[model samples]
Target: MGSIEQPEPTVKIPIIDVSGYLAGDPKATAACAAELREACENQGFLQVIGHSVSEATQKKFLDAISRFFALPTEEKEKLSQSNSPCYRGYEKIGGQKLDELDTNATTDQKEGFSIRPERPLGKFLAGPNQWPEESVVPGFKEAYMEYFWAVHSLSKAMFQLMALSLGLDRTYFDAFAADPDGICLCRAHHYPPTPPDAAGRTRGVGAHTDFGALTLLLQDTVGGLEVLHKRTGTWHSVLPVEGAYVCNIGDLMQRWTNNRYRSTMHRVISPLSHTDRYSCAFFNDGALDMMIEALPGCVPEGEKPAYEPLKVEKHIVERYVQSYGAGGTYIEQRA
Candidate 1:
């Protein structure tokens, strides 16, 4: 007789309140770390509340992004990503194809702008960002940078929790992440309402796994994000909760943990509502030259590491080349 198939368990993404950790309470921090371990191992995703990023600040940054996206196509095109060697600046709707492995994949129906830490002109992915004139989008740069630092701080805190979860010293990951060469890409995405006829065909962003260490996402209430359940082969919607940032482990983290933590596949479906959707994703990867290898605590006795050590930046550059095709020339040249 054939073996029976058991149904997959219904999994809800965990919501963790990080206020105590932010306040430096040891017990609360450890408790949250335990919860985070379970969430990362089982679903690779969770929502973080009480992360200390102000609501007013979030609103200001999002408002500025909305205004920037509302500019004339010509003006927006002036900062096109194609013009940037290091992959910073504006990307128009239908400019990116996220699901490179899917033959039927279409260009994503979202517009976006990307920025990274400003550094000397010779550094790859570390040069100055292309911005709209102050007259074009008042307060855009200021608001965005403020939010960037807030999120960066939160990411560092999260790393501490992750270390505790893995039975390592709380600062185990800090050295790799502390360098100026650490690559943190901040992206603002705008998904316009899909027409009825196009709703069935297009995606705001195609199904893909993030390629970095961690992703912290702030999404507006127009919910369309979906995550794939590996065990069930089913898709689940991720509805946005007010004032919470959705957080997820990414490929690099999973590699570092020897797959003890997951990096699940996720995507953004086109919104059915007439209202637009806005989201900001901050991807925190460790330093460019940092070697990603399975942590000792994550490997069981007599088990081998699942992956070879990889240079963080090289891995990211390769993924970008696959995803962006011709637009990935800068990294390709470097390779």
Candidate 2:
């Protein structure tokens, strides 16, 4: 039988107020910070409301996602997975990584477009991003380019919350994430309808933890996001809370905190209904060249850093290729 989503206190994910953060109010920001700490530690995930991005920006991004997905298969294939250097461009279902797959796994059922922006000063952190010429999807490039900056702005505020929640100066993560050459991708995804009652078969994006610092997901009205509760080890559907972006810790965050935090597993089950599923995820990451070491505040007395510091960019690439089947294929690989 198909399961209906229920509100479970078995896990308490926060729904933070970003009003103060947006208004530049210090005290309100502090309150939100404390709420964030509880959410991160207790649930490792949360819903964010009051983020400064206006409804129009949200709509434009959505329009871009919907437009890209609406294109005919023949057109999308022009910028096939094989054509891109750093694994950017249009990828059909089963093109990149599937769940539970190693370096090479059978392609899964899903299609997506990945965009990782170039730094302003003529430097590339991610493998080169391969974009289709504007002719392919009129204004796709223009809309996406603008969207990246706005998402970056939201992510920076998120990082500050993370820093404060961990008992550090607000700028603690600034140096690490600034101009990161990391795989900070804007992944626009679509999962077509699936068997309506295929009880517990599989999902559009099978169970997996993202390979970055934070993931800011903007989901359409037709929602299918679910998370694995760390405490009970049970699954729960995050009901589609309109105008609220879901934020969750990624694998790297858990490693950096030595498990004080968690990178919970999540997935998108293809909807049983016959509607196309559209969602945009801003996967915030740093430069692969930057090392991710344990934060001093997270390390307990006599407890050493759980994982050795590794370059954010390289570590993520290895995992991406290992997870999705696209590594070092997008852009020119940097040292």
Candidate 3:
């Protein structure tokens, strides 16, 4: 007799609500903090609800970016990132290889536009952004800039919760996140549908760890995000949840927690069907020059930290060099 087939195991990424905590309820804050600790230790990825970014704002942001990407190829290439000293502009598909280890294999198959709100020249990556001419796309800059601040506000609150999760005071990360010049980097990525033949051979983005403190991602319904399960050792799809932002820790956070929290490896694969995928990632890296090391609260009673201490800028720039090569070089001379 043939054996009965086993049922597929259910896989779910944890989702947390912060509305109550955001409202200043001490009990809710503690509960959210504990949940954050568990999620960080195990999955390293979660969806956040009650983040206070309204649906209208989210729609406007997406619409503005979608309009920009829909422009003619020549028009978009006018702002090619390769020409930017600050590395802030359009990047054509296959411009980056996120999985630096697989040199012989395919590079990432997505196009992107990166922006950092204009600010004083302070650090390597800090300066004005490369935006499309106002005449080309009316109100584009304003819409994107508005969304940047909205998402950034949410990131700050999440940092406080992350601090509390590690059994530290809520203000633990405030100093690192206090600088406006080093505030954040936002990227809008567009992944064209995967060709039928390239389905198994190419990835929209290669597997890699984020080289920052925190990342908040807003994705369209054409989900292609996947996370590697720590225990199962298999990749699972992170489906889109309406009105939610996918949140995850980054390398600096992992170092700060002495490996107590994870900086999980993740990647994106394009839809094999005709659907395109769009996502905007808001990365809050903390003050660029801030030193990153294991917090005393995170180190075990006698064990040494797993990673060596380093400055936030050093770690981030090294990762960029790996992915963008010479194109990632920081431009010192301002135009």
The lDDT for every candidate, in the order shown, is 0.83, 0.73, 0.82
- Tens digit of per-residue lDDT, candidate 1, span 4-25: 1222343587999999988999
Candidate 1, residue 274: lDDT: 78
All candidates' TM-scores?
0.93, 0.87, 0.92
User: lDDT winner among the candidates?
Assistant: 1
Tell me the tens digit of each residue's lDDT in model 3 across 171-223: 88888765675748899999888678752434778777898989999999988
Q: Which of candidates 2 and 3 reaches a greater lDDT?
A: 3
**Model 2: residues with Cα > 4 Å off, grouped in runs:** 1-12, 101-107, 119-129, 132-136, 180-182, 195-202, 326-335
Residue 122 displacement in candidate 1 (angstroms): 3.2
Cα error, residue 186 of model 2, in Å, equals 0.7
Of the pair 1 and 3, which is ahead by lDDT? 1
Q: Give Cα distance to truth, residue 19, candidate 1, Å.
A: 0.4
How are the candidates ranked when ordered by TM-score, highest leading? Answer: 1, 3, 2
lDDT per residue, candidate 2, 111-191, as tens digits?
Answer: 888878754323333345666567766777777778777888888888888888888898887765556554578888888
Off by over 4 Å in 3: 1-10, 197-201, 326-335
